[model samples]
Target: METQNLGSSPDVRSKNESVKSVDRRNFLRSAGMTTVAGAVFLAGCDKDDDMTPTPTSVDLGSGDVGILNYAYALEQLEAAFYTQVVATPFSGITDAERSMLTDIRDHEIIHRDFLKAALGNNAIAGLEVNFSSIDFTSRASVLGAAKLFEDTGVQAYNGAGNLIKDANYLLIAGKIVSVEARHAAAIRDLLMPNSTSFAGDDIIDAKGLDKAVKPADILAAVKPYVKTTITASNLPTS
Candidate 1:
């Protein structure tokens, strides 16, 4: 699992990377409170805070913080998946597929790192994933899992949008969701080349909008791929 640095090239820069140099730490420092859409995330614990992880389950905090943690968790899973995909490329993988998958792995790594940096101490622990079900040696297995993860990620962000109180956080979520959607499309295209599956009717509504799934539903859908017991009991419902 050899991932490339975010500074590999100028064109491959991500939304957060565009702020300054591609150094991950530098990006976090540059973004500190002032630049991340001007929203200062909650710092320090409080007596009224209800976010506490039990021995059995990881609790995603409430409000905007919870939403950020939720996003971070998903990115961790995707990053790990892509890392494995690129590290042990499926048999008979084409050069184009290899290149595209590698690029995707980088993007996912950036996403995971960015969220971890932004959350600082408030971020959740590194998630332990279970990819035992996926056969990395088979292109269909790998690509199918990729498609599921990407599509779920896009829907997760979209559904969490209205629950976010901070406009800055909402804006950032929008940016990330757009990237996730692109990833979803890319994976879909790879699975079914030169076809309408990229924007198929299954994911898109009659109004041409992508599906927006609730956090609980999204988590349940991805439970098979994740080993950690994540509890969102405190996450915002409205």
Candidate 2:
């Protein structure tokens, strides 16, 4: 897939550099989620029936490779969703809405490609998505799906951050999640004016920390569109 480089927003770029400067060892230690060895470790566990649907499998390799594939799977889903929205715009979709979604589609495509490149032969095959249930003709339906996707993407990154042993991989995820958060906020405002879309209990906790949804929760939310089951058993576990 061809991708256009969307130059980083100033604020995001600065934050990315700051995150890169942090000592990986110290960061992981402070988070209390780090394991002793740098080696990738996987715990053998049965696939959760609720998370894995009866869909075709996308082979994202073992260890960090698997994590990259996991992300690629999500990007494939998002890219397909936004492509559909652009191809057949929903009724009453504003010109601004169309433009913003197009930009998001471009960004996702770029992210997907970057991950694929990083993974090389380890990258998983592109997964097929079935968006037939979405009503492309209705503005409410389109925006609703976008909201769900963006929110899910952000939460997925947050939940998975601690599990990543490679500092570079974690940095990339941090960059991507910031963009996802921006997308979520923008979609929220479009849906409801002057109201914070990510300010609710769904994305934030009572302690003011951002909410992180587990992989099982994310897969369950995405189950409808994915035709094949995704196994995260190969992923690294702390």
Residue 175 displacement in candidate 2 (angstroms): 0.4
Best by lDDT: 1
- Candidate 2, 42-120: lDDT as tens digits: 2112122334343477555566677777777888899889888888987755555566677677666666666766676
How well does candidate 2 match the true structure in TM-score terms?
Answer: 0.74
Least lDDT summed over 10 consecutive residues: which range in candidate 1? Answer: 1-10
For model 1, the superposed segments whose C-alpha errors exceed 4 Å read 1-56
In candidate 1, what are the lDDT values of residues 158-234, reduced to their tens digit? Answer: 89999999998888888778767777876675566446988988789899999899999999988988888998999
Model 1 global lDDT (CA atoms, 0 to 1): 0.74
